[model samples]
Target: MNFIAKQMDILHHKADWFTHIVKLSPRFLLALLIIPVLGGLIAVILPAFGWAPALNQYTIGLEGFRALWQTPGLSTMMLLSVATGLVSTLLAFVMTLLILAAFFNTAWLDYIQRILSPILVIPHAAAAIAIGFIIAPSGMLSRLISPWLSGWELSPAGIFPHDPWGISIILGLTLKELPFLLLMALGILAQPEFGKKLREQHKVALNLGYYPMTAFFKVILPNLYPLLRLPILAVLAYASASVEMPLILGPNTPPTLAVAIMHWFNDVDLTLRIKASAGALLQLILTGCILVLWLAGETAIKYSFRDKLTNGKRAYNSAFWQKTTYILTILVISFILLALIGLIMWSVAGFWRFPSVIPEQFVLSHFQSASVQMVNPLFNTLTIGIISTIFSILLTLLCLESEQLNSKPISNFTSLIIYLPLLVPSIAFLFGLVWLQQLANNSSAYISVVFSHVLFVLPYVFLSLAASYRRLDRRFSHVAASLGAKPFKVFLQIKLPQLFAPILIATALGLAISFGQYLPTLLVGGGRIATITTEAVTLANGASRRTSAVYAIIQMALPLIGFILAWLLPKLFYKSAHR
Candidate 1:
């Protein structure tokens, strides 16, 4: 009993010490990271209950939710959102697995890895725009192919830009997500602990006469799935709550919930903001439901196949299926590359129209052209992106350190708050944020826009740093402390040196996320600040394929720059440090 009491007392002392150490560090960076997120959360939740002080509504009620429930075609719109999200995610997941299986040990693996760096850099918004530009009815593809193949004159009806099924939207999102998931899987596979053993097990199963895909499914995938859960969840959340893709490819009548929410938020009717807030809350719930369903399905699949795989049979003949998958992958990759090329062409084409196989003339005048309006949006985007990325990096470091030193890591509840932006439709919270901005009479659109970008970028920064931070050796810190170094100094001198690569990668990821932000930038900036994403969307809405293409190309370029910087900067630093 005395020993138990002593242990408890020591544990209590340790706990208090951990708390004191954390408190001593400046937490303002973390505070800055979370404030806008909380503001947005409060805005959404409060408006859902009809407690908008701006409108002199003191009493809370369910009128907003009721309105959302009563909205016509709401169920259909939600269903469309679900289908698009699930189909894209499922396809991306399957394709990623197939690619990983096929290329894990081959000579082609290095090339595959190298290809992902550039593709992963291209922002989804830009990718979506490129797809829209090429595949839309009257898009470059139809315009180019119709005259030659069909000998048919291209008309609005003949071109199927916004098909009712939303297939293009699904394809666009799937294409964008494929490279990201592949990159994430590469990162996971690079870890020595998991993939190496899994590969050996797979070979054994294959030798034992199990179907190769089944062996992969029964043996390899289960382990890969856990390492991949974070990226998969991110992909699902993104597809479910995505604004830009749906804007570009979803149908017109009742667009995806994301598009509807944006429309509601931007509506002149102040009442619509409440409805939009409620809808955004609903979107969050829907994403949660999908996540639950995915988890359940994953478990069910694992269990259903477990018994079948117990016998350890393997099929040696996988060549035919392997060849087919290889061809399919090539075709898909080719289509994506062609779409990217089409976007480049459209951007520079002078007055290119339908029925022409190529541009009549190319011009650099568009690239050279600059207007005050155009220039400011670009500057605003960079400014906000840089600010958000820097703050996200600093906050990520703090959260990672806190998790390291404390016995109890940060709770899922706190982590959920960081994920709030990704899990909910951006338009939903921005509706409430705009209301809050109006109430405060603080309409410096640039500040609000940057603040909103911080909210969206935080989760990604935190996530990218999380595994790297946890995997770090604590002995460095212990040694530094023994050498009389302060906690801050140890973090800066020892821990930071080791963590520099991951920190840079996380910052780059954050910068990419910010660069792609469309809804927050447009709404919080009050149409006053524009980024490449906003510019592309605006141009798309104008139906000027040429201008939209130019913006999309610019959009792709910005994130590409970030991706290259992320990949190269680390190698440079690590090489120098070793020397």
Candidate 2:
């Protein structure tokens, strides 16, 4: 009897400890995310004004800004950054709305989702490299049409993939960001209550003599845009200051402001750090201006369309618009597919001259040679991705569970906090973070890199898991409680099992985000640690095409394998449970 009573007491004590940890999770997560950003910004602000103690420059001045202003091609770099960001974002937003307008509430929507879902796992760097391979002057498309169609025995001489106008950068950003915005919209539409209301509204408009597309634009879009605003803004910020994509596909003469900032930061002269910090701040300001312009454009369009929205005149010639949407969708998907094919072909090509439809021969030497060099980077990539993803999932689950225990949802302020990492330009604050890391004298590059990854990865993991976590039926929990199960046990056994699929999916997404990280890994690791993305980006810049393609393929394959496992594991678990 004494032993039984002691066991009960110990269980109760453990339960209390678990509850405390759950309650503390929210505060811990907020601090973990918010502190680094705040600290990094402070660090950058000081250095930008030329007050770096490490360099023994204690006096503050505007010398950094002055140097930044006089830098050659500064104006061109700034223009390219703004133009590429805004154009890509606008194109992606328009494409997303058109695709949603044409396919929402139809079986076609499901088909489209399945087809594009895998694209999410393709990292931005890998996608950029693939697109480069497809559209370069000597790329696959040129080879396909060379001797036969273009009547040329040589690859075409045209500006692309490194075009001075940054068109290739815009194309790469648009293609990669389109899937993200589309998926976010789809998730919102997938909500049972909201989706049903939208479908009913569309039906009501149809009965009132509205064309399907017209009805969607008039009735559905206004309601949808509010929910999509945050995501759209996030896309704008990222595209405006992106590093990896620009590094691979952007022009070198005066690369985008973000890439130029990275170059300045890495230059051999330590004085360049001050200029880089100044450039980082300017990049931040430029991104802010672009976002402001976008918002103003939104306001103007809203007023301009206010009357037309309620004019009661339906668009009658919907067939052409619908056909246009279909064709555009097909073209986008085809480009992505062809890019993948190009990567595969280059990975195995053997000394084929240009204008040839196919390589003269195929060889495995690229893969065999690259494998030896890839081992350490591959291991480091997996280590960082796995550790960071696990931490993100655990924290996300705790925060959600705490919400359940308290019977309250997170506030608007907290939502903004959750999105802070996404909304802020990475290049803006990451340098500040490196400065702080050095000041603290912490030398574990691996730990620093993993922690840095968590800041970015946590937001994505939470966004992915929160909806499913909240939508889970509460009845199961109540029944378990009535059967005398403790809260922790219920969470571990009942809730977790029910949420296995979503958790796995979120885990895969977190891994994808981690795998794609370039700036965070490079800056935080202090150039001591290399990952697949870093290796891939380095090779894509100057190495042989065949070798770059091999790394790109491997980089893409990692996340895809994670997604595949996420899909397969849930089915196997449920089947066995039934058995």
Candidate 3:
């Protein structure tokens, strides 16, 4: 009996020690994320001042800035970056609001979500390629109308996909980001109390001689915009600093600053790294300025419209706008679906030409060729994605568990840290990460690449999984503990089983994020680690449609598979509350 008592005492002590460690897990995660990002930013800033010891530049100077400014057409690149970023973000925001206001609980919302939930999982690179394939001068739409509706089909000269106006770039970014904005909006708007409050407010407006659309616009939107601001800012930052889409679609006379930064970074002369670093900082400054302007706009709008929000005259008969919004939503979804169809057709197409709606013959040569070439890239992509996602999910679970255990909500500082990766241009800080890796001589291809993937994957996993984890009824855990279940067993048997659906979905999100990483993979992996995304982006520079289609499809397939399983595995076991 004494021996058993001593053993019990030892076990209790061990459990206490473990509990204490778990309590600190959240702080550890914050440090793990904050340190690298802050360190990378500082590292890059040093290089921008010509202070890179790797290149034997011991003295700090502004020559890098000077070179960056002196580069030809720098103004055009800068303008393109700022314009596309802000405009697309604005478009996405307005579209999301209009769609939600016009059709929140209707069948339209259900249908749209059902279709878009999967397509949005396609990586930006693949989506951009699909959009490019559909809108190019000799693309599917052009083919459909050529030689019959229009004359002489030898690929007409047009300013799409490579236009000076950056319209193609905007379209691609908007198409891809619109769905994400919608998803984020759905999350906020789906809160029961928030939805009920909005419905009540909207109903009051509706009774006061306002259409539903107008009612939502004047009443619900002001209350809703704050929830969306961060995501909007993220979209703006991404659009402005986007490298892959602009590279594939923007003009060459003066590419977007991101592409130029990439060009300078990849230039043979190692000294150009200084100029690239400066350009990256400039890009960072540009994104920061955009954010400042966005906040300034918010304040201006709030003060200017605070009274009008309550007293604005109701616009009746908004049927036209509502109809337009609904039609526009369907059209956008149709275009995306058509683009996917275009990719599939092109991938298997044989002897396809202008004015041909369908290919005359089909062949598997491209797939066969892509299979052989992409074997290594696909392997690397899966490994990196799987490893990074596993780590992110594990870390996020622990962090959230710690949060719940401590009964503490995530602080503003923690929230900011979580969002830092998305806000800063990867160009600005990833180069800094590259420099750090070089300095520390820790440039192993596989490890660096996986670490890079985790940096990006963790945020998405946390945001998606946090809601589900927090929303689970506390009574289940309470009852389990009352029955003598320990915390670990409660987590394993109760929480994990209950959250399997969301856990799997979050894993899929992390997987998709990891799969789509481009710059992080490139800079950290040091060109030695090539994933399907890196290869796809490189191929998009000039590769043929069929070949590019093949690569794009493969990249899209991984995420599609994950998303499908995320959707299916839940229903396979039992009725899940996740979907």
Candidate 2 wrong stretches, greater than 4 Å = 1-15
Report the error of model 2 at residue 562, Å: 0.3
lDDT of 2 by residue, 474-557 (tens): 767766665667778889999998899999999999999999999999888988899999999999999999999999999999
lDDT tens per residue, model 1, 1-579:
444533443344353544365544325544654565567667778978888888777678998888888988898789978989999999999898887776655667678767656777677778887887777666766776686676757545532446667787899889889888988887777676776888788788767776666677678777778868867887898898888888877787878887888887778887887788888888878888999999999899878867766664454356776787788778777788788888888778897667776888998766666233468667876888899889778767777777656535677667656666666556556776787898798968877788888887888888789888888877666655555555666677888888877887788788888988887888888877867778778777675676777777887777777767877998988788789
Model 1, global lDDT: 0.76
- Encode model 3's per-residue lDDT on 128-215: one tens digit a residue: 8999989988888788788888884688887889899899999999988998999988888778788789878877887888877878
lDDT of 1 at 211: 65
Worst 10 residues of 2 by lDDT: 1-10
TM-score of 1: 0.87
Q: Tell me the deviation in Å of residue 3 in model 3.
A: 33
Query: Per-candidate TM vs. native?
Result: 0.87, 0.96, 0.95
- Highest TM-score scorer: 2
Where model 1 places Cα greater than 4 Å from the true spot, the runs are 1-42, 58-72, 143-148, 153-156, 207-212, 316-320, 351-353, 370-373, 403-420, 435-444, 470-480, 570-579
